[model samples]
Target: MENLSTIERILAAKQSLPGALLPILHDIQDALGYIPPDAVPSIARALNLSRAEVHGVITYYHYFRQTPPGRHVVRVCRAEACQSVGCEALATHVQSALACEFHATSADGDLTLEAVYCLGHCAVGPNIQIDETTLHARMTPEKFDRLLAELRSKP
Candidate 1:
């Protein structure tokens, strides 16, 4: 399958280096949107690790997803600081707006919503990051709508 070849190519390129697991996983996810579940065995074998170890690493990192992801991802911080500043309220607004739950993608495949522990913007809590690239802090329902509109505008 295509996925197998991709895994092989990545392994060929990165398996020789020390600490290769994370980088290999990242590359696979970057290329394929998510780490395919079947990738575990190949990855484990290449790195001479147990499947449990590979799977553990994947599950331990919230950033590594095991399923196919939506076209866009929205991560809302739920850290203590963010919560103290109404991240819950913002999360509620995001859920309502997207009609999607955390750890799930929108019905139309428009976006995936997830709760992240932190984005390191404690000074401006209630931060939300779009597609892991854009960080918006001090979020309000109104701001969320605007951002959603901006996302919809993109191809």
Candidate 2:
């Protein structure tokens, strides 16, 4: 976990939109790798929402993480289109290669795997987004492994 003071800095941003919980959550997650439990009260106070309301919002979003993430987050598309193109097998191969289950991080703490509903690249099918960049069309297991190796090589 990052220092709680970091979260306090984020809360001070006052970035939430009226009646829009998602943007606030996104900003928080973007600033901090994950949402800290202590943020619930702070967010509630800032947004003029109840603690339960803030907590509910956090729990409702699958994009939110309660724990720190690995240095890189790998999201594999698992929507119907991606699955139709063999994403399941690709996902299984990635899990096996990394020795980490979905939503789990590698032992080296370099990668975290997650399943995403879609990347809006169905035409490419079986797309993957590594961190903020989307890799379109070519998400074969072999390619994924190579990409991982490339990411590992970086300092």
Candidate 3:
């Protein structure tokens, strides 16, 4: 299958590097969105590690996902700065509106909600990043709806 081919290529490309495990994992995730469960054995064999080791690395990192993400990834800042500015209420609204909890993709697969520690925009606090780009600062429930509507309106 194409996935296997891609994984093989990724492994071959990064296998020779020093301390290659993390880079290999990162590359795999970049190419496949998430490391497939089946990938653990192959990676472990290639790197001379145990499947448990590979899986442990993948599971230890918050950035690594075990499944494909939705069309959009919405990350709301939950760090102290943002919380001080009422990110909790904003978070509640997002969860309610999206009908999915943090780290989950919506049933419709249109959105993935995540809790991020910070967006480095504390001055504007209550920030949310959409799809790794487009940071919206000083967010409110109303702003979120309008933004969601705008995204949904796009073909």
Candidate 4:
């Protein structure tokens, strides 16, 4: 899979849909781990869209990653529900402990920290999503550290 480029993956996924710019992009990201710079041209040609149009979509969505992500991604919910529960303080603690700001990966490459609008856990408040798994309710700084440690130890 390492030898397979983003263009190849995008072309392969393009066959499945008639007008699949979004889906193709999703699959390309899923396969390549991130949308490479080279993919813009290939995707544009395949979808008959301008290069600028393709780039615009990619840049517009925060979910799209231009660069490769770390092994683990940690997303903190920053919606009003979470904010009322002191999520800002927790976010600061997490950033300080990891030594990285929001939307950035740690220097060790163990984690990528991102801010999310909501996690649908408003009642619990101060929610976090680790990778594909969501953790709800009362997120403390210490608990976050334990979760980070657990993710770091994974293969």
Which structure among the candidates has the greatest lDDT? 1
Specify the poorest-scoring 10-residue window by lDDT in model 2: 11-20
Q: What tens-digit string does per-residue lDDT give for candidate 1 at 12-92?
A: 999999999999999999889999989999999999999999999999997899999888999999899999989898899
Q: Which ten-residue region of model 3 has the weakest summed lDDT?
A: 25-34
Off by over 4 Å in 1: none
Candidate 3, number of clashes:
0
| C-alpha positional error of residue 31 in candidate 2 after TM-score superposition, expressed in Å | 1.0
Residue-level lDDT tens digits of model 3 in 1-155: 88888989989999889989999888888888788898888899899999999899899999899899988889999999999999999999999999999999989899999999988999998999998679899999999999998977776
Give the winner by TM-score: 3
Candidate 1 has a TM-score of 0.91
After TM-score superposition, the amount by which residue 120's alpha carbon in candidate 4 deviates from its true location, in angstroms, is 1.1
Sorting all predicted structures by TM-score, with the top scorer first, yields 3, 1, 4, 2
Tens digit of per-residue lDDT, candidate 4, span 107-136: 998889999999898998789998777575
- Clash statistics: count for each candidate: 0, 0, 0, 0
Q: How well does candidate 4 score on lDDT at residue 35?
A: 89
Query: Candidate 2: lDDT over CA atoms?
Result: 0.83
Which stretches of model 4 miss by more than 4 angstroms?
1-10, 15-18
Could you tell which candidate, 1 or 2, scores higher by lDDT?
1
- The reply for model 2, stretches above 4 Å from the true place, is 1-6
* Each prediction's TM-score versus the true structure: 0.91, 0.88, 0.94, 0.89
Candidate 3 regions with alpha-carbon error over 4 angstroms: none
